[model samples]
Target: MHFQVWLQSIQANGRLKVPESEDVWSLLPSFPLSSFSLSSLSLSSPYLLGIGALASLTVYWLVTRPRPMRPPCDLQAQSVAVEGNPSCRRSALLKDDALLEFYYEDTRTVYDIFKRGLRIAGSGPCLGFRKPGQPYQWIPYTEVAAQAQMLGSGLLAKGCQPNPEQFVGIFAQNRPEWVIAELACYTYSMAVVPLYDTLGLEAMVHIFNLAEISLVFCDREEKASSLMDNKVKGAVPTLSCLVLFGDFSGDLLERGKECGVEVLKLQELMDLGRQNLKDPVPPQPQDLAVVCFTSGTTGKPKGAMITHGNIASNTSSVIKILEGSFVIQQEDVSISYLPLAHMFERMIQVSMFCHGARVGFYQGDISLLMDDIKTLKPTFFPVVPRILNRIYDKILGSVTSPLRRTLLHYAVRRKQAELSSGVVRNNSLWDKLVFNRIQASLGGNLRFILTASAPISPVVLSFLRATLGCLIFEGYGQTECTAGCTFSMPGDWTAGHVGAPLPCTVVKLVDIPEMNYYAKNGEGEICIRGHSVFRGYLRDAERTAEALDSDGWLHSGDVGQWLPNGTLRIIDRKKHIFKLSQGEYIAPEKIENIYMRCFPILQVFVHGDSLQSYLIGIVVPDPEVFADWAKERGFVGSLEELCQNPDVKKAVLEDMRAVGKEAGLKSFEQVRDLYLHPEMFSVANGLLTPTLKSRRVDIRRVFQEQISSMYSKSAP
Candidate 1:
């Protein structure tokens, strides 16, 4: 009776399904239970016992099977308690299916990435550098890796052990040696501390001292000399050696010796490395790879600690997005002109290298950037808005003829319409006649151009897209996120939005109640949490804690709003926004961007205070434009003298009003009074950051008296 009940339970559960044509005894394979023989029992009882025992064994196996192990780096599975809210748990942004696949599959370090690229690109040109009035010199991938290995061996031989805490500094402009030195450091797990070549002496001294950089690689003799100078060397006593990319002069060597530091040439180091080449210590993904300093627009520069995994993960996501949206091919080429010390350029370099793309460095002069662009004919160009503004001004200035200007205007409108309609049936004849020439100026093979660092004017963006006949993508990020957090994809041509967040990067808006920025209103401070976010500010725990919350979100000070299309639109910087006496909030950057589009204005600083009812501006007129205006009006004076002239002041004020109106700025937002300055804000003047962004605090301090006088005079 028990055996019969077991058989009935198995049948009810659908665990056993016998074929209609086959008998139950036949399906049992003539097998018997451990203690019962099939022949000894009746056929029906034998079948029931055999099926019941088989079902029991199957259930036992199912219940006792071992489970598969989970990956150690599964960020989503590791939840942490949020500070002040113990009930809330926060995890890394790994919910996206594509991001999860990438996270699990791509488990390589910076060194590993380089090796993979080398294997694929063997003899292909990896790094190219050109001197003024000379052809470009190309170094293949294999050669770069071999030299990097040798350099790593040489550094180890010279008592430079693999110490992740003690960093090596790369203080130079964009060059081939800069990248090679960076890679060599990775071979021995040394963190690279990149110092912007344009940093002030004091700033440079601060970084060298802060990071405790023992060895520094200098691009030229002058750089080595400047660092080894008596005054600066005293400030950075921790620096022990200098490696010059160029031939080390005896004078520079003597200067280093006087400073109690050793000096060696790059060639000598490479030779030493070749002699000492042996087993190398490879860097791990979690090891500190770089300590990139912020531009210090607000205060003293803070070094952001970026790990090998941070770079690898960010670069991989970037490559995936670019390839998906822009179809980046292995044969694509790029020109490296931006300061590589900035994470933006550095990230691009790594991504290009990862995909086996060739990179050509520009001659160190900005004036020759266009000439180099023409020669290199890069397929991919990453630029700042300043460069784009200059290009637009130069191109528009050249259209002196009315007929040509009219034709160009029509072409731009027609192209814009086609882009909006998304029905590009055929290329317009105007493209072949007018736009093709503009494209040729940018190497003709250009597919897309990337703009970042600041918000670009929509007019300029549209004009460039129409004229060049190439897609324009704007990406938003900071040093904290390894450069890219969000990017505008190909079909995402919204005028003001920065498109969507990159895969694996989760971007959300958080409330800034004091500033009236709220996520509920679709505007707030942009916060990010993901693989790309840096570990923290090196050696600055308080600042790091403030920036990165216990929930692991990096609270970016930038303010943004969500667009209707689910994209991000940067509104204004929370710190840069100031409330006027009338309780009107003004975004100086927005106003500055508007006035900058005016032909006469070269650079402008919009200033306001909570105590003041109106706005005042410091405008720097374009030298050439100002000269032309002065000549046409028969005004006789230097630029400085002309700035004080009422006529010139009135002309600039009128232009500002026109631009502000065109930009749809509110009445309270317009600059009511202004002062013309002949000199432009620059890094040398301590009024601009190395990245060419205005240092607002410094500017306000420097022009304090001028601003006060202007406000006093304008009082009713």
Candidate 2:
């Protein structure tokens, strides 16, 4: 049979349903060409057999092909420190013996970024937040600077010492007051320690005592009351004073007094500062700025001592990357919704300040994040992967009409084609007719959006690019490396890999012998060395030695592969892998990522340990999808009732298995049993980290019985 005849026959039989695109060659293997009957084809047995062999060879070649390792033209590689693989890489933007410490300002510390913002954008809108029935309110840079100075003075008057070891805690969400207190610590030589709710009361007490934190800035009265109660219980001995950011009742103050903790309203502290003003004492380069505790995704939270130089250099790297493509400006605004307690969001906010840009706070509501984004109408959005995932799922679920779905699919293809061809703008016909609504949801002025914290799927990234009508860049970093080591540059069109290392750092991968990942093969554990590396964990020399080497390389526990284009692709975890009873080493995150794509699954926790031969998943079902599923199946029940239905559980498990199979998960990797969790895995539930990454330790604790039962049921 002719080639055209075979192709047409396969197409006619519904075996070839891929969209026509430049990436068709890459998409061809995804279709089930094996289903094409050889008996009906006019070919000899040898010819048919050769066709199968050729197809297999082609697919293998495509799968194993090397990814690009060098950045685009003009940005060439300088050197490779590892043999056989160019595992060691730095941006050509950074020449030998060169680093970006201060790009926009002569900044030696975090306090300097604030000072620079005041110098360049004194009266510009700096920090902003919205009120009910009112537009966003703004605090100018000068006013913010003044408040920070006042707060710094007030702390000194309250007998807090001015030194890097003197930790001042801020236990609050993202707010102007949070920044003010943080900056206030930076103004002096004092270091800031952010407390997260994810780190429960025990961890909080541990951090407070470990760092000897005497005063904590609290935004909520309940938070203050909890701290006082803990203090009264003799859990936290160092607690001496409490400063409230918002309104507080007199009863809480009396309760604080009884606990021997001084309670002062935010304004009272600022007023106290008016009587005892002191000159700003900026920290030295190596002095600690923020002692960011890890969100405890794996185990106990460790305080990563982020120095002034670490953050200052990271901010410069961002500024340097955006200089030629999309420069940071005073008009550029970002909505700070992610936890400021984490290094990633804090880094983003600090970068905005260095550029004299505006930052608007969310209304402390995750559901209303997009509303805040729309209200602020930010020009650039910094977000996390889970948020984008929800948006992706929501957009897909909302496109229920068959005609509109088809159009949406084609529009995505056309826009993706345009994006790949180096055309990115919001005025295309596809944008006006198809994606305008999605764009409008993000305030309609976004020129680009950057997502970090976790890996976002390539499909979702492309969809965001096409629909958002803006550049979408993925960044990779950890709290250990001051939040960002590599960022997908502004011009790179393809996804999957987080782009090349930022100019501030040099990145290399070391061999993980047991995992079969080697630097010689262009894949291993990512290691970073430069000014941005943290200044060791607070009072934990043993773990700090493990994290940072004598040569100053920070060993990031994430496994990465170097692309041919110099971008880094996160492949697996250097930690978090569990060996099964059958000797299969399972990366639960890889399997979880696959199951998370299912329509009915909002979040999935895949668990398998040395004792279990097979995997079991605890799935948080999408509420809307779960209800729709029950309604379609003629069931009448609440979410909790539906979760207990055997048929519903079986259906969801099948869906997960199908998704895993489609994603090419190995047999051992595929989950055998599933428990439909009616409630989402959230920080409040003690099942997830603040950043939304699953706390495996916590999940295992919460579902210990369910997990054991699943293993028993799955035993053949």
Candidate 3:
């Protein structure tokens, strides 16, 4: 009988001789396959089983195959639509005036920004700091606001009036009190002048007199004592009061009185403010918020009058860029280890607070920075190249055995390949076996690292990115630009470039004919114009005129080139480029950066004269590396003796040659001869700026005799 007729007859008879377990197969009559006539085939036929298996496999393949991922732009759009607030969505589409309008749509001053953040953050930890050997303790945002209000009121009650032309000075390390003091100033529209803790007493006095500071906030009694010194007091005659974040002994207060100054503790000031809690004046967007002093690499430090709008606008732009590039959550944590006086760190602090991210201050000692980082487990870290170099050196030093070193090298190579190919066949296994430990050293939660202030070695950048499995971004800006004007976007991954101009900012390269730099040649001094630019240098009209032109472009004095992708690569400092007798322009800083990457070399200063054909260098060898080299060569003595040893000099020169070649430097640009210097250049030695940039003028002066001798010997 035919299969369909037999099946219908069995169903009608209700007596089909099928077992209960086989009854499920009878349900196949309800499926579309029922139409297929299989009566001619036996139940054990191979073709019937083959066709059924193929159909099942096809369905499994169709269901289990991977789908293509959405593009980054699409993902960003979706993220904004789903997670972002209405303002954020609107701000993303706004441009130029509209963008600025959007940023200022709800907030005008930093006080406004803080209040908005406080509203969202509620009772969350706002500022965090730790006692020695203790976990971090936090002060809530609401408490911070209340304290700042009381402090501002107290300052006003104590005859400290807000003056647009005058300022209050904050000379301290990063602390909760610093933020409270700054916020208090904002509450009363008082401009703050942040003094670098590393600054010499001379520089401190100079800035105090220059900025006409009326009152100063000191981090400790020691700092407060420094201000009470006769010379410091004499230089800044306008100074009338001192506020100490730490306790002051009776002797210290009496000394302050002798210096014609009144000293008060932080809590005492706050109590006074509570008593004077009346209508307080708020700062306008155009009001000056800070008088940030430049590093003074070449001359006296000029205070850049940064306004509320200048920093607020820059902070807003930075937040917008970072939000698009990274996954920033309110729960994100950060460590504030960089000098808070520096614009870079200060701007980051403002940005973090604005985003409601908790910030922890490191202990006063930098040696404990890693411990602090480990404890904080920060999600975002902003650093300078010096910090990165140290971290890289430590990691390299950890692999003492040759076999482990070789394994690490191979693993790093594999990681680079995996990142490049966008494939991870065994990433989880690799992470478990190798990267987890490294990540754990950094608290195992670091997602992004920002490097700026100076150029970093691309090799270091790549290695860090590969090993940490985190995005490393480079940014370029000076204090004049309110910290950042250009920054590498997440996932861009291109080395030696500082990305494009930030939204609401414009960057252009202008010709420097004297140095042979031209925009037409794709290289020139980078000039910037935007709301982020400083208004002008405080009380230095001549310098301000030199920096900012009538057209509103601030001449950066740093040379850069635009890549095909429109990213900016800093080439050299315009003022530092000197032409040789052969008419070849040489940038010592650029060459120095390359050679400094050598493991044995700690610092380098390349010098070339206008009449010279080749360059000479002053090399500072890494003490530990030099000691090892000295021991191997059977030389035993002080660092000075090791530096002067002929064999050590030869080894250094060889390493320099190898590093220079690897950097692809031109022959003339290479260091032909060098003088080994045992001392490391430092700000205290007057050889480096407060920001750690070498003071070329001072270095040249210090090494003038050696430079002359080297040139005299190489004379043709």
Candidate 4:
């Protein structure tokens, strides 16, 4: 009998199929059942038979296994959360799959989404971010969209096209006009290229040259007017159209004309989009949505080609992550304060649109962030670590009297205990006696706090977690990844790790023996592969090839390791590591993080190599704390003087040493000598990125003299 014929025979005979078929049927062809004897099959034979059975079972299990998922909350809740918000609606429309429908199925395109929001919001004012003393105005979404259409039409009339490839530059700060200009650009299927507000003219020229941007939208003539006033004829000869967002009068237009640049009021362009809508709204999602510039820390900025699909996917990933954590419902609210030019905040804004969450725009400037939070009573917060750190510092600084400080610490512990239980007390005697106005001041609706951009200090993390009663999640990704990669679960969080890779996102470590830096166990370069990884760098094939390998893994350029619990820990940038003469490499960020944790210091740059036998640091002491400490001690001096004093130096050094011991650093690695400086490194100073990470090379160069003096043996 043949194997196949015998298997059919076994089935006819009503016995087990797999091994029984093999044993009684297939094996009999070799020997014959008539000659077989069961008595010879002993315990060892049974063990071998059992092993065979287990192997078959394993294969069967493998074939039938269920798929993995980090399940999100009820999908229905996400669909309705941003019901009446224009920005939220735009995000949803961008993210929604044609196969899957949301509650508002008709909402499509940025135009349609805003139109629907207008219908839903009815007569309400669509508040824009404002400057202080500027009267608040509500431009309804209907009017806003109409105005955008008019401006888009005006551009088309001015010889701009409805083509999907033409690029328009939106170079301005966050404001209503910025949004309107973007919407107008979308109406004509023109790609809106975002320029950094703080970029110097040289960098601006590079972008304009590369992008071939003809039409530029800026907030005021004060912005573009300054360029005209400076007699800087932009290298962009093709740059024909310039539109000012705010009210621009005669002199500014005359100034622009002198520079040979034609200027139009933002309102005039918006009116054009409206007039052109009589023919048709020409833009669609298939058109490129934006051209966001990459942060040029390593080289000149290259545009990352962002499509509506890219924006939508990233937005969905964020929404799904939030849905998993917050169970965000229809009434949940969020505040948008971060720069829209950056991917981190842009993707979040898109997510808000998709989820139907109410989004409040901050009234211009981050100093008003707390005020905005209180006014909106937002259920969600998306902030960088610097802001969170400042908040933590303020709370810690408020304890004046020694006895009162002791009592406050105990009260915080008690509050943490109450938080551990599900019951929250806003007006309990214990609460009134303790947390009080601080809790009320934060506006109480702050339930979901999302921190990103840079690694947050563990101290700030723990403090917020203990007090806020909100679940704060840290997300990690790059602009190249379109902001969809990994996020720490509010429930399953570990400080310093950026959670597990997001669902459907594959993560791996590439061993870089040349780099010699490894995870704690043995580090490797972190690589991610997924739908979210960018197609490639725009117009830079060589650079794109360097970043993305043949198999489509994006080499993240970040050194990372898996925590024991399988969370991802980003250690430092590959470019950030430097070697001493001894050939020992040091990761500056790790050492800097330790210093930040050990002291109330805001920023520190640790530098030393062949020039010095050991490391020395330039510390930027926290000004707020230092000032208060000085005032309390009846100390009077300039900010610089306070930082240079011998007493202050001794105190800061002790803090550094205490931090070193706690972190268990080796003698050679610890800071041997350090100098305190009054001024903190900031984005405005070119020492930090908008994300609040120190530009290590820039810092090293700025403090080169201070560093050289510190390492000199006779200098002290």
* TM per candidate: 0.82, 0.87, 0.84, 0.78
C-alpha local distance difference test of each model: 0.77, 0.83, 0.76, 0.66
Candidate 1 vs candidate 2, TM-score winner: 2
- Model 2 stretches astray by more than 4 angstroms: 1-85, 97-99, 626-642
Worst 10 contiguous positions by lDDT, candidate 3: 79-88
- Write the number of the candidate with greater TM-score, choosing between 2 and 4: 2
Model 3 scores a TM of 0.84
Candidate 3: clashing pairs of residues: 154-273
| Candidate 2: C-alpha RMSD after superposition | 13.0
Stronger candidate by lDDT (1 vs 4):
1
Between candidates 1 and 3, the one scoring higher on lDDT is 1
lDDT tens digits, residue span 1-716, model 2:
23344446455884533234324355455556676775656647576567556655655665654333233334323233433436787775665536566675587678888788788797999999987546899999989989988999999999988888789999999999999899888888899999977798778888988898899999999899899988999999999999999899999988887888999988999999878999988898899888999877655679999999999899888877777677778888988988998888888888888878999999998878777887889987888888888889888878878899999999999988877766777787888999999989889999868899888888889988889988788889999999899987766778888888888888999998877899889899999988898989999999999999999999998899887766788988868887999887888887887788787778888888898788888988888667776677777589999899988888888888898899898899998888888988887888878877888888899999998788777443
Worst 10 residues of 2 by lDDT: 69-78
Q: Write the per-residue lDDT of candidate 3 for residues 1-716, one digit (tens) a residue.
A: 23344345456785333233433334344445655566756866575456455444544554553323222232122111113212111112233234341253656678888887787788998899997889999988889999999999888888877655558889888889998999999988988899875566677778988877778899888887777784344777878899999787999877777777899988999999898796668888899988888777667888898888888888777666656456555688888977777788887777777767788999978779889999889988988887788777777877778898887887878776655543322234556676778888998888778899999988888777778877677988999988888876544564777776666466778788877788777788888888888999988899999999999889998888866555678888876778888988888888888897998788999988878788888999877567766677677788999888877787788889898898898889888888999998986688987678888888899989999888889532
Q: Considering lDDT, which of the candidate structures 3 and 4 is the better prediction for this target? A: 3
Residue-pair clashes per candidate, as listed?
A: 0, 11, 1, 27
Which scores better on TM-score, 3 or 4? Answer: 3
- Model 1, 573-601: lDDT tens digits are 87688899999888899789889888878
lDDT of 1: 0.77
